[model samples]
Target: MEATPTRHPRRWLILVVLCLSTLVLIIDNMVLTVAVPTIAEDLNASAQDLQWVLESYMLVFAGLLLTAGSLSDKFGRRKMMIIGLSLFGAASLVAMEATSPGMLIAGRALMGVGGALVMPSTLSILITVFDEAERPKAIAAWSAVAMVGLVGGPVLGGALLAQFWWGVVFLINVPIALLAITAAMVLMPESKGPWRKADPVGMVLSVIGMSALVWTINELPKGGLSHHSTQLSLVITVAALIMFGIWETRSKSPMVPLAMFRDKVFTGASFSLVLLTLANGGLMLVLTQYVQFVLGYTPTETGLAFTPLAIATLLFNTLGASLIAKTGTRVMAVLGLLVIASGFVVLANMTTESGWGVLAGAMLLMGAGSGLAMPAAMAAMMGAIPDEHAGVGSALNDTIQQAGAALGVAILGAVLSSTFTRHMPADAPQMARHSIGDALAVSAQTKDSGLLDAARSAFTDAMSATFLVGAASVVGAAVLAAFLMKGKNSGPVPAESAVDPATEAESDAMLTSL
Candidate 1:
């Protein structure tokens, strides 16, 4: 008789520890974005420096994810997590005390390494501790914690920026990391796959390929296809990824089980998530800027403005979790995505005269759609992955979402910048044409309120165009989900789907305590 994996008695407690680990990562990023302008002024940093301050972390984090995930599966998952938490806390201290842009950038890069290690282990460990029957609720709770981070990050950052130095933002992460590490050490059981040969070549290739790919995407909108830097990065990205694919196939034990892609449900879920994240990324990027630059809201007010979206998302998460078993993953995904597209359409029509009411309604729709869609899609995708490869599988999902969001930021940002420039008055000063920030600053110096009006108008026009693109992308994702995903995806992936039957019992026995 086949062994059934025993559910952990303290699984819910473990989930709480996992949420704390995730909270530090999510909240820090959101908080950092809110503190950007203050950091620029305090450090006397140039535009490029600020860009690096953000992108450097993402680049390093994405590059190391697959390797970190694999290592977690090889070493103890809980051990890797504690080490990651310690490193992240130390790095946050370094960043907190940074005296210059270079110092802060270095600190952020180290944190990226820590983040990569911590991130995949959380999901993989969650899957190990929770059985399929309980997986949806566990995931819903985990995801809801992310919503809390999203909501609280800006509010906390706003309060910190108002009272303390910008570095106080990083300070919050220290205690949170310490608490999570302590709890994880006390409560979490270690989990790992059976001993296998390390694929060093695969690790190197994946890092280089993913890093280059992200860099290429980041640069594409800024430099265009013809630029030397973009071309070079593109070449490196293609070559390294192709070589990585070839190496994985021939290797005795591959870093990734590439055969998993053959499953239509997995492929479909991944594709849909990429597009969904793309749309959401664009929306958040543009909306945050609009609420501040165009609407003339304080940073704190802007943070408060997002509360509706978070609330709506939280409520729908519970609703979706409750309904998923009956409706299947495909229905939830399609319905949620369409609602998101509708939200985008609403936001696209927003004019300078439109008050917070319209924007809030659109945010509610976006949140509701996301709450319904994300957990279902993730549940389906994670369900398809085998138990032994859980860590790497989680990393793969993260990579897909990260890449998608990065692409969205680049593409939508470029569109906004270019469209703003075009819509600006021909007589406007060169410095004021590309960015609303620059425009407002120029207007202040020149005492030209007409320039202010022009900038705001141009920005609204640009925002509308950007949101339309987001809507189209989400609509495409909706269609993809409808056609590609199949069957009821609420249950766990079949045991025979990937693993060897001879080792199944042993794997279940080890994983039950995970």
Candidate 2:
């Protein structure tokens, strides 16, 4: 038997650095969500405008992931990370000083661009830093921190908003970026891979396709299917995607190697991740509103309510890593999904007056389940691909995750909004008799406390219904784990030997040299 290599001592340090960086990115993401009302109040922006402020960042970030990954490989990972971090900082400043919604959105887009660079490079760095035997642990820690960032984004944002104005959230990134950049410079060594040239065409196609798809999803609520605007966007998006696939297939240096998905593990892992993300993203957004707007929790209270999720995520992340060695992939993935489904079911039953203890338990269970499932999914996906393509693999991971979150928000938001509108107080509905748009407008101006409570009831019902959908999604993922994610870590490594030794050594040194 091959002797297991000692895990690098610096592994923990690398994870910490990456975790901190990810925290900054995630905090930036939802910080704005908590601050949205404040921002709207301060900037005099409309609901639609605020939505764009958030969606634009995600749109640009998700759209550019492939290009960023390939470019990082071609130019240099460390250089790209530093550049991205710096840009992120600069963008934060822009966000901090924004005098208009358009300016804020532009800054957010720039932040997304920085995020695009940071996300994949961080993952690639982690993969090289730890050996296979040690990877699950490292990834678990990384994944847990990431999950905290995901859930805590709103919490942190809420906390910041409680004390400071909305700009403070953007300013918060400045200090974190300083730490990350400083540490990275002193610690992270230079690394590069074998891309003789960048695939500009492939990059363009990916951007176009992802942009169209996301835009289509975002527009669906406003337009629905019958709206000519929605139809036009959907048609254009589908056409763009078809062109993107054709371009990727033919490109000599494809951004996403079409062959990668040929492996069942790769396709299955990606597909499962997409579904998981969709449910997670959408549920979180709606839940925040439900807790705050409907349940009438203050932002700080909302943040505190989610502490269980962060703690549970951390615990499960560590636990899941430890279990992966013995439990194997199938058992771990299935177990995680099952647990997640249970959490959703629990959440489905949540009421405005739900007990803290019960709510905490549900959040903890969901966090644990998510922490368990994500690392396994990521490991399976990355494990199936070649090391040389780690950048691409990481990009694929983020791509699915971001896409899932966006899709989740789009689908669930539409459902929740529609349901709320339809089930609103009879008097309120009568008041909205002009048009759905007119009713929506009237609903916004509603101040009647009784009518508000009625509306809240409707929103709560819609949220519960959505949680059931999320539960169903998790169950579906579990079902897939049973059939598709067969075998232990026994699957053959895909064409990862495509990575050259010199390049591997350089990247490894980059990750571990400190």
lDDT against the true structure, each candidate: 0.88, 0.77
Q: Residue 182 in model 1: shift from native, Å?
A: 1.3
* Candidate 1 lDDT tens digits, 172-245: 99999999998998899999988888999999999999999999998887769989989999999999999999
Residues 134-242 of candidate 2: C-alpha lDDT, one tens digit per residue: 6777788888777777667877786777788889989999999999998888777666677565777878878877877888888887768988877887887788779
**TM-scores of the candidates in the order shown:** 0.92, 0.88
Model 2 scores a TM of 0.88
Instruction: List where candidate 2 sits over 4 angstroms from the true fold.
Output: 1-9, 425-427, 430-450, 487-514
Best by lDDT: 1
- Distance from true location, Cα of 338 in model 1, Å: 0.8
Estimate the overall C-alpha local distance difference test score of candidate 1. 0.88
User: How much is the lDDT of residue 239 in candidate 2?
Assistant: 83
